[model samples]
Target: MAIRAAGEHKQRITINIAIDGLRLRDEKTGDCLYHHPVHKISFIAQDMIDSRAFGYIFGSPDTGRRFFGIKTDKAASQVKCREIDM
Candidate 1:
């Protein structure tokens, strides 16, 4: 029997990262199922030490929400939503 770690998601999904936001595209439909804007990307969560970020959170325990069209209350979280000059 193979042992599996908790919170280990092995689903193969296409991820597109652009200047505006990060998107999770459906392989079959070619439709963007999830979108996390660069501004609202609270913090990149790492599952293991020195590992790549597996979670793009919006400064909350809830993952079902947080998107581009969805307006997030910036004042509620510690993150300053001010845009940095590029």
Candidate 2:
């Protein structure tokens, strides 16, 4: 998880994701389903993090999928939404 300094009034946050790059090799045929990367994977989990409107958002690569949620001030309880595909 990564935290970014967003606004002066509220705190902004972002997430970091890292997937397995190695391919699954077949036992019998010795076939590879996926190929691994030569170098370490480096990518931003969320492209955009804002609190100007309803909440914060992170756009997908194609802009078709989005992951977002609302902001909360209460420490005891918090409200957030799931990833919505648009």
Residue pairs that clash (backbone atoms under 3 angstroms), model 2 = none
| Clash tally, candidates in order | 0, 0
lDDT of each: 0.47, 0.32
- In Å, residue 54's CA in model 1 sits off its true spot by 1.3
Q: Candidate 1, residues 3-80: lDDT per residue as tens digits?
A: 245656344456666678767777678888876677767654333432332444553455454422221222312222
Model 1 bad stretches (over 4 Å): 1-11, 49-53, 59-86
Q: In candidate 1, what residue range of length 10 has the lowest lDDT sum?
A: 77-86
Worst 10 residues of 2 by lDDT: 77-86
lDDT, residue 75, candidate 2: 26
Candidate 2 per-residue lDDT, tens place, 1-86, comes to 43335434433333222243323344456666334331322221222444222333333456443333334333212222221110
RMSD of each: 10.7, 16.8
Deviation of model 1 at 75, angstroms: 34
